[model samples]
Target: MNPLNPLTPQDAPTPAPGVYVPGYARAKLGMIAAGLLLMGLGFSQFAEPLRLLLFGERARAEAVRVVKTKEGLPDQVLESDRQVTAALEPRDRSYTFWNEFRFADGQGSSFEVRAPVGSQLKPLYPLIDEEGLPTTDLVVYDRAHPERSAFPMIVSTWFAPGMLFVIGTLCAFIGSFLFYWAKKPIELPRLPPTAPATSTEKD
Candidate 1:
């Protein structure tokens, strides 16, 4: 053993390359796929709201009446006296209300449309006027399909989509980070430098 070089050939063997873990790779791919699917689902939920915002026509429609019904039950007219009690009812009770509106298109063609979104608790807008008659409210309808109309309310238009968008965005970000980390090149431990061999000669 050479005193000048403490490290021997046995001590400096090259490090073996990192081995691929099938389970880890599969997990990474699954995360990425799930994130992408969530992003697509969330984005697709915005289609109707975006369509109404961009190409919809705004008009005043008469609040003809409110229909109150329970799931799997016949619809009944929501009376003004019962409005407050109904509104205060718990959401788990499954009672819901839909507002019916009557409006005319630019061509003077009459159309009656129901609100696309139903309220589980209370009516979205007031239907009665000071004189105790049905009143007019703002509605946004697709010009191409007036039958598809909705009240211009935030909850009906954007609340659910916005929540989904946020959740999807967060998931996509986490998934992307995990994927990048999983695909990063594995670094092998480096061997220490070996000293040059020296020879001694005798005369």
Candidate 2:
């Protein structure tokens, strides 16, 4: 018999790792990664339409798409609503805009962009819906110079705080659960025994 073996006659069961073990850390990491992915997606949607103006003439020459009518004619080619964002230098908050395009047989509908909350939102605009469309600016220059028709523009926008808040709440909830499972249970308090009625010495 091995002296090191504590069990006399039977095999002892092995104890599993606690909830706070490395396994839990790995699980939390996975959750964090997923959270980051969601956060990234939200941010990606916001970083579009960075002003092409920043690019030099050589880069601008490389600009692929020609800026046609900003607002497409009503009842024309229907376009899905697109989102764009900008987080410029020195600014704590970011900006988000919803833009869309549509046109019809001959007449075209104006493309509109909206910002839910931003300093540039002088006249409130709503996101385009299936029912109808909104107004937009369409600059027309010389007919021969279609290239000049394309213009660099910015959509009204505001900071994206909702995603950060949601991510924070999820992390806190998961972290708390892991911590709770790893904690040891508390011991119950002892109660005082009731004193039995006995004859007093004087009595």
Candidate 3:
């Protein structure tokens, strides 16, 4: 006899078979990891810019001025190696170029430094350009180390890392929600047809 409802011929409710969604589970896990990595990388990228912003005055104090030797412009300007289809693609490009910053150490040893192609740094002293000769002084680190070299920060640097951070965060949130909230598809059991009824009479 049916315990819940005796009037109707109904099967007892049972749990449906479990679904093995391997891909879904894997994706969810991947998202979590990707999110963490992206966030970490994004924060790491900001380290130098933030530091410079906070203590630029102190860093400037420690920097030493070095002279630029070349006249007119530095000879590093060359045709864009990047091949574009259009001939009139505004080919003129100016890159920040400078001579190596050399300074004397406390022990009378001299050290030289050349800032990279697109650094936005100026010397502590005024640039000296006279007669047809162009010369500029640059302020750079008094000392050099493996991790600490002066490089200018640009807008593009923040774009990719910031995007990764945002995208990763979104992916992680979506993955976590799916992991906790998504319901599996269930397969219900089929019910058998009832047999035909027959009547009997007694005389």
Candidate 4:
């Protein structure tokens, strides 16, 4: 090698043994905690769906009325034209729309319940009829608690739980990977052997 050239692999100093990074333990614990928290939340969100699936009674619910409310505002009724217009336009503020459904329980008790989930853009469930009246929608309510009901076969019913589960699973995988990485010993690349110097003989 030329004397003026930069140091090559053979000339470079040996790397130190890998050690735990500062705050790595704390980071690992934090990731694990966050993952578990999210997982718990995801599981909690699934409770209603699971309860409905196992011990729920299906019924045809009539929409009593559609209520719209902005975040942090009182609920109010919106005209169908206004609702459609609001849905069509870009959202400038957060709004929630839900339908109040009236249905009878197995014991012939009347109960009015709100939709399980609200829509940000438009009212959920019970499509409007030609006469501008609410249509009938299927509702699944817990057998023991008739008031606790949800609209089955809708995306909103499962969206929260599904998203939470996915995010929690990803976080858990990342946390596990970090834990394994933290405990495992690190290895450095081995240096290649240098060629022996050649001697020029007198010709």
Cα RMSD of predicted structure 4: 7.4
Candidate 3 lDDT, 1-203, residue by residue in tens: 43322332122232233322222455567778888888788877755545544543212112223333234754442222111112122334332323344444445555555543333233222223344223333223323342233434434445666787788788778788765533343343456888999888998
lDDT of each: 0.68, 0.33, 0.43, 0.70
- Pairs that collide in candidate 4 are none
lDDT of 4 by residue, 88-164 (tens): 32465487777777899888999998887777766665456668776777888888888888787667778788788
RMSD of each: 10.6, 15.7, 13.7, 7.4
What's the CA RMSD of model 2 in angstroms? 15.7
lDDT of 4: 0.70
Predicted candidate 1 versus true structure: per-residue lDDT over 1-203, tens digit per residue: 43322332332323235322112445666777777777677678777757776789888898777887787878787546356455445656588777778999877888998877777767665678778777787777788888877665647566776677777777778777766655444454556899999999998
lDDT of 1 at 112: 90
Which candidate ranks first by TM-score, i.e. highest? 4
Q: Model 4 clash tally?
A: 0
Candidate 3 regions exceeding 4 Å error are 1-23, 55-153, 183-203
- Candidate 2 least-lDDT 10 residues: 58-67
TM-score-based ranking: 4, 1, 3, 2
Q: Over all chains combined, what TM-score does candidate 2 have? A: 0.27
Each prediction's TM-score versus the true structure: 0.67, 0.27, 0.39, 0.70
Model 4 off-target regions past 4 Å?
1-23, 71-74, 78-94, 126-134, 196-203
